[model samples]
Target: MLTDVLKPEKTTRKNAKPIWLMRAGAASELETSVQDWVDASAFKAGAGTVLVVPDRKPGGIAGAVLGLGDGDDPFVSGALASKLPAGDWFFDSPSTADIRLASLGFLMGAYRFARYRKFPEERPSLILDGSLDRSELVALAEAVWLARDLVNTPANDLGPDGIEAAARLVAKDRKMSVRVVKGGELQKKNFPLIHAVGQASQSAPRLIDMRWGRRGAPRLTLVGKGVSFDSGGLDIKPASGMRNMKKDMGGAANILALARLVIDARLDVRLRVLIPAVENAISGSAFRPGDIYRSRKGLTVEIGNTDAEGRLVLADAIALADEEKPDMILDMATLTGAARVALGPDVPPFFTTDDAFADSLSAASLIEHDPVWRLPLWAPYLRGLSSGVADLCNVTTDGFAGSVTAALFLQQFVTGAKSWAHFDIFAWNPVAKPHAPVGGEAHAIRAIFAALRQRYGVTRN
Candidate 1:
């Protein structure tokens, strides 16, 4: 049903054109291949190289060879998207049957968040010849694009209330139930951490909850940090640090997008999405770094830094999710710079105490081409969050291991869930790459969705 929007043409198949995806390496190993075809034709055969070779046989049009980056790093194969000429193309090989990566690259290449401006014409499509479900691929692409668009929008258009409205719209469209605790209601609800971080913003802080699916199905709870704009509260970020803060709610966008996919696919699981939307703005009433606040989990947290507000809101959300003792609890946040240091913008780092859940995620990530690496919820880092006056600190004073400590800080409130995982995502692309132009990005969303599918055994119609 979702695939109706992306009706395929007969030409959108691998056999439509013969294309070879080539990898480059040392000259010794890089003899005549697709790379040679690119070089011979005078086309730059660097990473993301797309070369069209004319058929030597009379009247036959030459097939194509997509140049992956230097063979040393295969992941950059996605770079080939930039090199291909504007036309439809597909992978030539049948042995590499898992076409999800190619599909992912295709969508990633097509992404351009040009809300303020117009997007350039998209390059021709690279069709996969394999038997993988075309409809699923289209749905996945649409979901990722949806997440990116929501992230790329300015805070003026996607503030806390706007984000809640979007969630409600999605819920209404899907015939799901939705609830929101806003303004004074958040205080009544005892979401003090959520209130403390967002009270200064005029838009008002709110907790968005959306639920769908049949009763008795395994519960899958997703919590996302929704810091719509991080002005860094009273602590304040330097001008450079705050420039792109509007993209701070990327985690919220990602969860909502993933939620849409699950509902669209009619997955056989009870799903709940929680987004604590807020703006970490500065005002006389803004929460301060030294302030102590009570969390929904009943834990007292000392504000180690106002800039670390993402984790604070996420803590309250995760705690509320844990109250349900869901089968799985996964929380996403653009919560730390330390994670970016450990792994670049492309690779999101996740931490979990459950070994089985981690392995499932690892396998799903590889299969989906939306990979995430696991970091330890190493208990030793717990000491970093100790507070002199409160039960814990929202952030560690020591600059080292900030990501790990942030994960650990959130973990303190997750007692009821059977399994819990935290994803520290960058949710942004500083520069353009093929279809994914510079703007907000949705990292690790696909992988987690794949894992959920495996966990619930999604049945196709």
Candidate 2:
């Protein structure tokens, strides 16, 4: 999809503009003519600043210069795709790592939601001459763009059926196996929690199960919460809070993004993707706050709040994922507002019982620029989720630790997996950054993918 954004070549054209990257106060070291032009233009090399120098020949761009502020973060180069004039461009760098990072930034920056903007902008193409692997970077950009597109679409166009359609498309594209249990089949299948959450909507609730890779490979299961639109059922959210509810299915979009990376890279993993698709809308049949539903895992959970439906759907899905006794289980959800309050929108909070997996994921997060922070699955918080009648409630009544208790609530259904982690992600970029535009965003999957690849990387003899 976005593969064309990056062009691989044995050599770059002489006319291709060389982008000279610099930190503050580094412009004085440039060649005499370029330095004079930069100085004359008062280019201070501030972060995200770009200035195109004119060639000695009239009206032509000789090259461009970019500012990196402290030179610590290379992703500032991301803005170059939109800021630079349409033409061929190459980074004037000797370091492989910087080039790689800068290239990634450029590829992501090239994204434009063309669905609504029918006319395409004249885009600049990055020319690479043996600096990086084009395939992996292209795969990352394509997957991220796919997730963003799904997240940015309005709820009218993206409902429960829309989410299921997306999963079906992936299965067809990859030629993988897919099985769906929908409507009354969900009831017959014993997915009581998932059905209860969506029974109020016209679109039926369903579980999308997709599998890929060899049967004997290490099992890696991914579960995503697919609440297409959360009207909060009978407990409706205020207008302001419900305005962006379309992005509620962000967790499902991100799981598909990561699944693309895993399958495209041909990793040595037997992957199972489980998506519980539903729409939490209000109606006469809507499940009430005090209602208790027996999950597919046979754990009774009292509905403490109607707005906490993400975990309800995911509980059944994750319980199903654990049934296979997979080596790892990772579920991502736009489950709680408290997560945003705790870490803001950019840094998601992940909870896991495995120390080694946490350390590996943390390391990968920084390297991949997909930030995630670890929150404890505090056993003491288990008391916060305790219920008087049922086995456990969906949320803590005191609300002292909303995000922590949410993770603990999901952790109850994951006893069978060797290692399990829950990613409480925002999945939406409320504010625009140099690289990421505002709307549905792909978070944490890159880092998670990198870690999984390292753990189960295929070795060919």
Q: Which candidate leads in TM-score? A: 2
Mark the regions of model 1 whose C-alpha exceeds 4 Å error after superposition. 1-18, 25-39, 42-45, 54-63, 70-87, 96-100, 120-123, 126-130, 459-461
lDDT of 1 at 395: 77
lDDT of 2 by residue, 1-461 (tens): 46455665654576678888778965355678888898899888888789999997789898898888865677788889889998888987877887888888888777777777664546778886475787888788888898999998877888888998888887787867999999889989999999999999988889999999888888999999999999998889999989999989999999999999999888888899999999999988899999998999999999999999999999999999999999999999999999999999999999998889899989998888889999988889899888999999998889788999999999999988999999999988888777788888999988999989888996231
Tens-digit per-residue lDDT, 1-461, candidate 1: 22322226455453345556555552422336645656677664456666667666784445666556563333343554555555666666544542455555655665655667774465655564546676677767878888888888889999999899878877886878988999889999889999999999999999998898887788989898899999999889999999999889989989888898888888888889999999998888899878998888889999888999998999889999999999889888999999999998989999997898899999988766676999888889899899899999877777889889989898899998999999999989887665467888878877888888777876433
What C-alpha lDDT values do all the predictions have? 0.79, 0.88
Off by over 4 Å in 2: 1-4, 8-14, 27-29, 459-461
As a TM-score, model 2 comes out at 0.97
Q: Tell me each candidate's RMSD, in Å, in order.
A: 3.8, 1.6
CA error at residue 77 for candidate 1, angstroms: 6.5
Q: How does residue 94 of candidate 1 score in lDDT?
A: 49
